[model samples]
Target: MIWYSHVNEDSLPEIVCSTGYNSVIAVAGSGERLIALLDNANLEQLFVVDTNMSAIELLKLKLVALSELDVEDYLRFIGAEEMSSRERMRCFIKLQNKLESSTIIYWSKNHHFIKKGILYIGQYEQFLSKARPLLKWFLGPSFMKVFNNDYNSFSKFRWKIVKSVFSKKVSYLLLGNKDPAFIGKGVDTSLITNGFQELIDKKEFHKSFMAHLVFLGSLKQMDIEFLPASQNRKILKKIQAKLKNREIKIQFINNDALSFLEDNTSTTFNFNVFLSMSDILSFHKTDYVIKCIKALKVSNKCKCAFVFRSYLRNHIDTDIIKKITALGYKIKDVSNMESTKMYKVHLVEKL
Candidate 1:
């Protein structure tokens, strides 16, 4: 199944989906997080495998529903056409199945912009206490653009000297992609601190602490450390639904790669690439690697790409690099220009 939804409004679950699995195990319609990684790695089929038909049914329902829409209509259906504080909170709460408790508490309790949510959704007031500041007028134009969630069109952002970097279009696109090259990918970014708690970036998140640092003072109140990852009620609901359906397979051992072996079973795969990150790392076992490599190599359809990471201080041994390079994969250096944004991924796939 295939779908196209807006950057933030889309309903997609993340997972560690693998390619060259020897079969069309499954495809997940809500596999938003996995799709970018899977697409980057270039896999062929996602058969939608899951022990729980409930999960498959849910994603299938979403995909079927979305397949009928272009991006704009879906945006409006999710309340993106107008960024009402009420609508925002409503939509966010609707996603509670995919969110966490911490995020719900954080949004309702600490996110100052969310008090209107309490006003809008009478359902959550008892769960919350404090109210957001009356600063809707104070949030600058740049903040409005973000509030609008006009996340694309980075090519036109021209206010280099005056606007906050968050106001730039590039930051928006990179933010949506979750690619770490953007400053918004890390500690200061919402997706990290907001998406998953354990994954929150600790170094540079733009919290009250960062705000305090900018304005030096002889004596002032300050919140030094970043906030812990908050659970979102929306994500939890969605996750619960997805887990109930059972399409994603995340067991570690059951999943790997090398080349000498071949599968003679009659099969056809519309593969464009086979990606790998661990190439004879000794940790990934040369034999499994060879099997994976051979499966892709034998396929008449795809090529491969291999991406790996190294310590900042270490250079790969030229010989080892060359030997892997001999497998016909090219190497490219990744630059983390957006320290705040985050999509830390590496792969070896059909080039």
Candidate 2:
């Protein structure tokens, strides 16, 4: 499996917000961003494609949870908060019968992942788990305080500290030097190295926060985008309502993006928007991406949006734009208005 079981997107919902598209094609990383988009917009159909079986199963589990469990139970189950193995088994059993036999059989062998909670299995989550302690040791308890309270005034000084902590040397040692066998497929080490460097340069360390933080000497608390404990219940409730009403149809296909596009010969489904979350540009070849674009049956006003990590914007954006343009699309750079400045967004419209 390339991506374990975690959500990798932060700005997809913000990009897709209020675009009332009838259909959407998205990558199912953690499925959180896709669900967020669903909650934010009314869609008739959603096609989520991923190459990893584990990721596909994880999405299925989340859908079952949303469809069956209430907000509190869903939160507890995913958050892994005080939920025992027996409790997890009970929840899984309930979810299992609700899912297809293939899904149940696939998950039954991976009960260990279920016990720990699928949300916590992502490679990005694992990285954050290891990096958080190191960050705390280096920045101390007041680290987030400087950003939240007086970031503008102290940004320069704090940036220096960030640079020292996340320098190129450290990033290369930790991410770039990983064993190829241990590293999942389609994971580019160079991109990871560049991503860390970009974060330091942008002084956007808050993007990586995996939990809520109670800053020192302040009653105010901040929630991270990756896993906001407070928002889980509301998002789940919205998804459940949509599911119950039969307002949305979400299909998960366990195949690479290019293969998924090529395999589907049916011209019945035409998507108005394609949300590419940097995986295609970062991992797959440009030729394959062009093929995928050619295979997709999009509307005349179809807009294909791509979100790239800061580091990749300079390296890959031009090539991607050129390729998409060659296939008869006009390019629009919407990165300036994006709330999460950590990523660069580009929209390609049919000419």
Candidate 3:
């Protein structure tokens, strides 16, 4: 059980606290942020939810792994503003070992599906080779930098949108076009609708729910690419070790947005906050919005909130807006366009 994922120390807690609800139903990205927030805030409980079973297993692995590192290492590895070279290498080795092991295990169990993806891409071999220039233009040096452990540079390359497209192809080749939560038909779309603006206004259900997207990951490509990089292997392991320590029970669900909002009995889960990263606008189903409203009714917590933002226009569902306002929830508009590039974060809570 290893969620071979890394989280930016700074952003994790902010999103966890965004809803202003002390308790929450959250999407666990690598469960890295969820775990870190738990440790830092010492919040009694967090329901880590996702559709990806691999994500669930991986988060469990990371939670177990983090305990191995001391608090200073956790701060340096997971919380530091920057890492010195010696510290970086020290962390690198720790992260790498777990990645190598997990990658091997992943391929081992899912080999056939993985191989199928490899064959599909062989048809587009030439396209892929030419793709590098375009990819390099966007993903930038960080895509290559992390793999090479170019510690000299500080900024990360773009979210690796360019690289991610290719990586999906690679993942498709081996994993058969779907991992735990991500798939076609809008299963877990981190990209499909990211920058789409006009489309947001078109959703029929928006009148009833204040819909928005979360764009959950920071440097989207880093977890997939860098964690598996030869140079990054060690750092990946250290990151894994840090996660292992937390002893959190994290689960990956791999369902759609609506399915995500429900409990086993079909009630909207009773939690304080719901977090989404950019998939709000991508939802083609109305049940998802209904679930949110239902969840609000069930919440014992005074303030229930859903936080959303996006890489495109932060689509606010006009109907949902009216409904929440009627329910006495105040919405705060926060912008991070410079940092997140078209990103907007909203904080909503019941007065």
Candidate 4:
């Protein structure tokens, strides 16, 4: 099952990798960030890796759609606009030839997800969709203000009320502890008891599509525009053209990233230029992540950049910071620049 149908992380890869990198290694969360990078960065190779096979399939489907469909049609096909199952299937037919045999079979078997719009098909997304009404009922008119982005009237008392309802108790009652949403996609519970708390606290609900999805259950046109790669037509078209012309190559690998790095120590490809972890750090302990980082075979001369995010603050503490610095990298906290205030983003560059 798809854990994340939409990526919550912002265009961090595009930002850090824009310093003239020819290739990128990214965790394929929902394919959105990869699309954003493709649109914004000039790259020759992109390695999209994910442990989830479904996530890889979603990325493949998106790539085929970009190669085949126009901006509007692509949007509709992916469930941005209202389109019937039959119409969606028709659109899928156009993309079928471009997809792998396995990907084609996967989508054909799970056509229900496509009919509902691939964008909202994730397990976590569906949980949010189902929970939206209850959230509205619990918060009353204050819920509407989240969508409207009107925080001036949202009082501290109301914030307390909001916090109570969105507490770990209620979330566990609604969605089991195993659910990706409740677990913060593999993060420790204490690290992020309530995923929406950060955005609400930061008063950044208006600027984040993730905030809209968590609070409103659906997206507005403005939210879509604010999203990383959804509505950037000219860039998308340019990327689409380049994709069709075979200028860029994207490969999807379905394997644990740490394992992939550790086992493939002899691989010739150098991941030294750019690596966008995309919150995958939360899945494994800091030491394990360090082991994986150590396993990476990078170019000695080329300056490398590593990007990662954590939900809570000071996740990479003094010891970890010292460890990373010893590895010849300087870490910068660019959390303020992230569109979604839900994460503390770290941009690490080789010194």
Candidate 5:
């Protein structure tokens, strides 16, 4: 399994909300983040790329659900609420005809996740399920209070409680070690620990949605925007409107990021923008980053946006920026961006 089943990236959608792009190449995690981007923009072509077949299958299931089900039913289906197993099965059956054979076979092989609901299958979601109870037990009722309150006013006692719960010992037991051979391969523990500590130290907990998710399991109590709501109806309405007049293409490719970029060098796929949620730089080396940037056949106005975890801002960001600049791209000032204070947002444009 991949290091992350789903990475909650609220900032990507916000960053590209107004930019009109004809084509987009995005990393597919839980598929929710990409869907959020799609909800805000209408593109001529969308390529959802990922190395994990399971991740691709998950994205396909989501696409089918969005196409077939209404917003409410789609929410219910993914949320696993107000629907029985049989009803869910019926929903899947209805969608199967509308999906490709490959998708159908993949879903059939992982029918358990389908019957149980797709949202519950990710490694991150499963980890949260186990950690939530522990968090509640350790923090007690005060957890909800602190989570809901203002971060600036978060008492010292609250910080102490958070620090105690997120200690090295607890993190090791909860998140496990950073061994690539493990099930959750190639994760940077500092991305979680040091990142959280930085947020708390800076008193930016209120702005750190990822931290909230790691500690509290949900952002509902955070009293701020976290993940966007499932905009199924909105997307479906747009799709229907488009189908009545023209054709729209959305493709999903199951390949590693480096290989996908490398193989696309000869294609005329004029991707106007690329959005990644810090996975490539965090997991892979600088050489792979250079290859990805080199392989992309982007337009002159193309902008590449990446959200890097705070811990990676020093070395990784410097190396990537140097390579991208060497390739003739100019770095755009990302200081004005909001909702991404927890991360170092990098935006570069092809010169």
Candidate 6:
């Protein structure tokens, strides 16, 4: 199952600015972030790293779609434009020729998702769709209006009721802590309630596609326009031009990230690198991941920027930041600038 349908981090600016002429290595989460990076950054190569075969296949399909289809067809085909299932299937059939044999086989079995639109195919997304009605009831009628204008206030009684439905006990009951379909996919038990609370408390909820998905279960027209990967016209044009000129190469590696890094450290030391470690550190032992990162072979001739995210609270301890700093790097917390407001983003650059 696709764990994410789009990017939750708002680090595109960091990724793009720091990635000029350098090689990038990013976790291929949802493939949307990778698409955006490809469009905006002048990278010589992009190493798409992920252990999940399904995620790799999804990115492969996306690459072919971006290369083969025009802007409009590409949007509609990916479910960003609300096309009919038959139309999307037809688009997929047209693009299937450019796909690898494994991708073709994967899509052949999962054509049902194509019919519905690939945007919301994630198991977490489906769960959100099923929960939308209940969420609407709890959010009351004014919540949807936030997308149109501003966040409307809820009465204390309404707030209490909403909180009850999303209480820790109830949430754990509904979304088990161990299920790969839920928490394992990074859908924290408090995500929905916290998202709603954030919307109620913050005025910028309208700017976030993630907030729309958490609250509305589907993308509104505004949300569609705000999607950096699919909606940015200039970026799309840049991507098409790069693809046509064969100026950039995308490599997909299916392996544990640490192992891949260890194996490739010899070759990577020659090039300036920007690594996007998308929330993987949130799941693994912090010391283990940090140890792997510290083991990377780099030299004074090249620079490296390593960005990682933590979704459930600020997962990075003070000692961890010190550890990263002790490795001859400077750290910046870009969480406030993050559009999702759901992750604590730490951008560490070797000086």
Instruction: Report lDDT (CA) for all predictions.
Output: 0.31, 0.57, 0.41, 0.71, 0.59, 0.71
| Candidate 2 lDDT tens digits, 138-238 | 65655555445333443455546655545434453474334231243443334433444454456553444322221121112334344432234566677
Q: Please list all clashing residue pairs in model 6, or write none if there are none.
A: none
Deviating ranges (above 4 Å) for candidate 4: 152-158, 184-203, 223-225, 268-272, 312-314
What's model 2's lDDT at 132?
Answer: 57
Off by over 4 Å in 5: 2-7, 13-18, 40-42, 80-82, 150-161, 164-212, 215-247, 268-278, 299-315, 333-342
- lDDT score at residue 74, model 4, on the 0-100 scale: 85
Query: What TM-score goes with each of the models?
Result: 0.31, 0.76, 0.48, 0.88, 0.78, 0.89
Flag the better candidate by TM-score, 1 or 6: 6
- Superposed on all Cα atoms, the candidates' RMSDs to the truth, in angstroms, are 15.4, 5.2, 11.9, 2.9, 4.3, 2.8
Candidate number achieving the greatest TM-score relative to the actual structure = 6
**lDDT tens digits, residues 115-212, model 6?**
87777787666656766678787767776677776555545576667666664544644743333323443345465466556755777677777766
Per-residue error at 306 for model 1, in Å?
A: 6.4
Ranking of models by TM-score: 6, 4, 5, 2, 3, 1
Q: Estimate the TM-score for candidate 5.
A: 0.78
Query: Which residues of candidate 6, in runs, are more than 4 Å off?
Result: 13-17, 153-156, 167-192, 223-225
- Backbone clash count, each prediction separately: 75, 0, 56, 0, 0, 0
Residue-by-residue lDDT tens digits, candidate 1, 11-61: 111223243332232223223322233322223333343333333433432
lDDT of 3 by residue, 248-331 (tens): 343445564345554454454455554543234333332344355544454454446655543222255666566667766776
Q: After superposition, how far is residue 79 of candidate 2 from its true place, in Å?
A: 1.2
Q: Tell how far residue 308 is off in model 4, in angstroms.
A: 1.6
Quick one: RMSD of model 4? 2.9
Clashes by residue pair, model 5 = none
Clashing pairs in 4: none
Native-to-model Cα distance after best TM-score fit, residue 105 in candidate 4, in Å: 0.8
